[model samples]
Target: MSRKTLNLDSTLYDYLISQSLRETPIQSRLREETAALGGPAGMQVSPEQGQFLAFLASLIGAKRVVEVGTFTGYSALSVALALPADGRITCCDVSADWTAIAQRYWEQAGVAGKIELRLAPALETLDALVSEEGVDKVDMAFIDADKERYDGYYEACLTLVRPGGLIAIDNVLWGGAVADPANKSADTEAIRALNAKLKEDRRVDLSLLPIGDGLTLCRKR
Candidate 1:
């Protein structure tokens, strides 16, 4: 009872990628570096996802973008590289270890100046930002942090994003487990509940794409 498109083998996935345009050299190198790092090679966003995010950022003309997770900087760099010359992105992550790698790649991408890396619990940072007046000014927000706190992040983002802005939450499908009633794992349950909540929430217009672990996009109304 899960999403079928989510189940593609390595060979088929590679074939699908081969059919599409390839990433630039710098992006390819970044992928290689992420692969070498190992433990969470999958943490890096897919090339298609990166390109899509970049286009989305540019389309919104986002000046003050916020990313809840900055694993090895791939997503941050993707957004930063697309931002306007005067644009800036705030990246939140708690691990110095993972972000250290992201820092190097951001420098290599020449986008380090456009990104501000904050090392702290994402929820705390989000709450603090919301607490500051004149700071409820985010044009876009990307949430990909702790599964258990997904709703909390969504609420915080609802307050943080501009009326017409977007909140892109990653892993909403949780590898299709959200649709599988039999899979009762904690992460799966969290995503399932969050999906149901968003589906009924009239505050935003929602679209759940079967892309990279399933990306749920919500635009503020």
Candidate 2:
């Protein structure tokens, strides 16, 4: 038996997806469309990661959610699909071009009515949420925006979610750069700082899984 996470080569990865992934046709179509965009398509979460987000939302019986990044809305769609009919998710992003693609798929998915897209700087949207919704009202939050401001987003989400609420942060490993001392680029440094901070922060129970680019699951205490 393995003592730690097994490294997934392309073969193993494909096998894993073949065995476990349950992507819907719409989801698959969206993924294909996003992939056609080339490099930027990498910003979208893997199918497994999207499924995990949906699982988390369902686990908590989440009624209200917030998303700090809404790239093509795959993650949002995943979570939206899991929410009850009355549930709502506020999505924050700045790219009209990208989110427009998201809107079409969301409409097709029939979850468009549940999502509120705020096209502005994420920080602004998050701050406004804190003012309007107050502390501990959100059930879950997913953060995947600008790496440099991750800490700020984390703090805001921490306040937005109640005790036992969840905040899922994407790219904590920053494509494995956080572990390499030589990669001191601005984005890498920011992610590294947040990783270190999250490890010690007693306000939340944390787990950094070896998922897509590393996903940090933080349950607020």
Candidate 3:
């Protein structure tokens, strides 16, 4: 195992969040609940990212949203809260252990009825959604699961989201690995490859933001 940590420089990270995030009571409660779970605190989405996600969902008038990584439901909750009264989110993850925490928080946030949690491989779930008639009607999607499958998720999301919709991909920078040529782990290479692929993909308009790791926003053209 490598001893190195992939974290933002403290000052810069704090500055970024401070400038972009506006914390609410729900976010505080979610953080406390995540801490209680103990093992997957990092799974929680950043406050700034959560607010940004809400903004994105509203911008697209997203009635149907999809998330590739539920991870205790923080991000799902963020998006769900922003959704219209009848809006819904399909959350996919392979972890029953972590999703249990997600379920609890969803109930606490009163967004449980808005979320459908699926315990299965994210790619499989995504592909199945694409094949299922009437289910490919997603307005927005967020991909934040295993880095190695980032490309697969991107392709699946591209098909799932409607034309002109948004797909927000998390962790594309891999904590700066995509910028360093020396680092060549499977995850790093996968992100680099996906980045290149997105640059050339004609189906979408893409802009990479250096936010919380890095987020690539793709709007289906």
Candidate 4:
């Protein structure tokens, strides 16, 4: 009798996947390899979340996207697959190691030409985009980098993304830690602050969706 979002238990979640997920072989291989990495593999976006991002990108007709974190490139690949042939995404990540794995999978998926990997601090890369390309031209931007710098990334993306463009932020709920005042970890605090700020922010249309670890999708207005 609940009217709100369903609280998905394992059985329900399995049923949901059984009904809706349409992961390709390339995506499955990427997920399996990422899972083999043990605990760190948890950073990879859930397969359904990847599908949702592709849908969102397609909805907005995204041709130029900026990704703040690439990690093994699952999210980037998912969106890249949805984009047209000439579409491009600038992927920012500090790790050459992880991005090498990403590069391999991206090439395997035939989306390598659509993605440009920048092995530098994401803030630096974002700032360069604003400086070199000017503002209000990016179709979309996804922020999933260092939590403390989320506000910085958001502001940079705010400047870079065109009006009505989308900025999708990952882990806004921080695994339910944002609502609990006791968890004062730096990352938790950062996400909490950003969530509150987004609520009051007049510049965008915001929705905090219960997808994956919690995705905050903001459309610049």
Candidate 5:
């Protein structure tokens, strides 16, 4: 057996999905609709990533969740499905156009009642959460918004999530640009800086996994 993570080519990746993924019909249709939007569709998490988020929430017995990005609502839907009937998730997003698409799919999925869509600047939404909910009130949080503001999201999530709760940050690798010193774009550098900080941050225990453009999981201590 290999000691390190295996590089998955497309064929192997498809095989892996065939063997392990359990996407529902609504999820698949949502994916297809998002894909039809062309380049912007890439912002949606892959099916496996959505499943993993669900698994994490279920594993933690999470009932209260927060999402910093709700693009078309795939991830939110996934997690909502795993929560108990009384559970809820507050989704932060500014795009009415995009989240409207998300709202339709969420309604169809029958998880609409479980999700609250906040259409405003994400930071404003997050800060308001801290004020309204107080610290340590959230069970889990997912961050997948603007790369430049990831640190802000992470900090807010750190405060919101209870001790031992998790904060899952998406696109931590920024398409592998964080490792390339020459690729010093603003988004890339912001992600790179967060990666470095997370590695040493004493407030949480971290793991940077090589899943879905790199997902960083921080369990608040």
Candidate 6:
């Protein structure tokens, strides 16, 4: 199998959360609100991942971030809360219904001022940033949208972010389906191909963490 990660059964996973997970009122409320919507609420990242994103952004002193997906605003809230008051994050999403919910929570969280939502195809928005905002202006990017476009989103983020800036891509593992050859769906294939490409692409240092459906962190070199 070549994989060395310990299998996380429910008991072990619960223990891990009990030992380390920290949930703020705002975060908890947003999560509950998202959950109340049900259906695709599973798409909301785990609280641990949200905290990790904030910690990573703060650790690197990120001032500007581009978020490629803004479902209910949890991830954006995570990174936005960590940023300096003057910091900014541009969010790209196609769902006005979902983003409207996100906006309400962001306002309640008081980070609304720092987050800017652009309702368009993420590709178009990302490319516009490269042309209008200039290369190396963004400090970080988090991609969690359509799986088929991960490569294009990554390339645009690579251009927008400063050298050494981070581009975090979610769902690379696709619920462990990426490793299963039996799963050849369009999304799965796209993620698998991108993972293989990243293995040999020397433009950045990479770490594929087994968190919240496998997040791949690529730091541009």
- Identify the runs in model 6 with alpha carbons over 4 angstroms from their true place: 1-3
Clashing pairs in 4: none
Model 2 is weakest, by summed lDDT over 10 consecutive residues, at: 171-180
Q: Write the per-residue lDDT of candidate 1 for residues 13-99, one digit (tens) a residue.
A: 888788873466777888888899777887778887887788888898899898998888788888888898888888889999999
Report the lDDT tens digits of candidate 4 across residue range 1-221.
77899989999999988899888899999999999999989889999999999999999999999999989999999999999999999999999888898999899899999999999999999999999899998999999888999999999999999999999999999999998989999999999999999999999999999999999999999
Q: Which tens-of-lDDT digit does each residue in 1-221 have in candidate 6?
A: 65688888999999988998776788889999999998989888888899899988999999999999889999999889999999999999999999998899889889999999999999999989888999999889999999999999999999999998999999888998998999999999999999999999899999999988999999999
lDDT of 1 at 180: 85
Which candidate's lDDT is highest? 5
Error of 2 at 200 (Å): 0.6
20-47 per-residue lDDT for model 2 (tens digits): 9888899999999999999999999999
Best-to-worst ranking by lDDT: 5, 2, 4, 6, 3, 1
Model 5 spans > 4 angstroms off: none
CA RMSD (A), model 1 = 2.9
- Can you give the TM-score per candidate against the true fold? 0.91, 0.99, 0.89, 0.98, 0.99, 0.96
Show where candidate 1 strays beyond 4 Å.
1-12, 19-22, 133-136
Each model's lDDT comes to 0.86, 0.95, 0.86, 0.94, 0.96, 0.92
Question: Residue 196: error of model 5 in Å?
Answer: 0.3
- How large is the C-alpha RMSD of every model relative to the true structure? 2.9, 0.7, 5.2, 0.9, 0.6, 2.0
Residue 176 alpha-carbon offset, candidate 2, angstroms: 1.2
Superposed by TM-score, candidate 3 places the C-alpha of residue 97 at a distance from the truth, in angstroms, of: 1.0
Residues 1-221, candidate 3, lDDT per residue (tens digit)?
75654457889778877787776677678778788877668767778888889999998889999999988788898888889889999899999988887788788788899999989999889987888735448899999999999888988888888888899999988878899999999999999999999999988999998666789999998
Candidate 1, lDDT over the whole model: 0.86
Which regions of candidate 4 are displaced past 4 Å? none
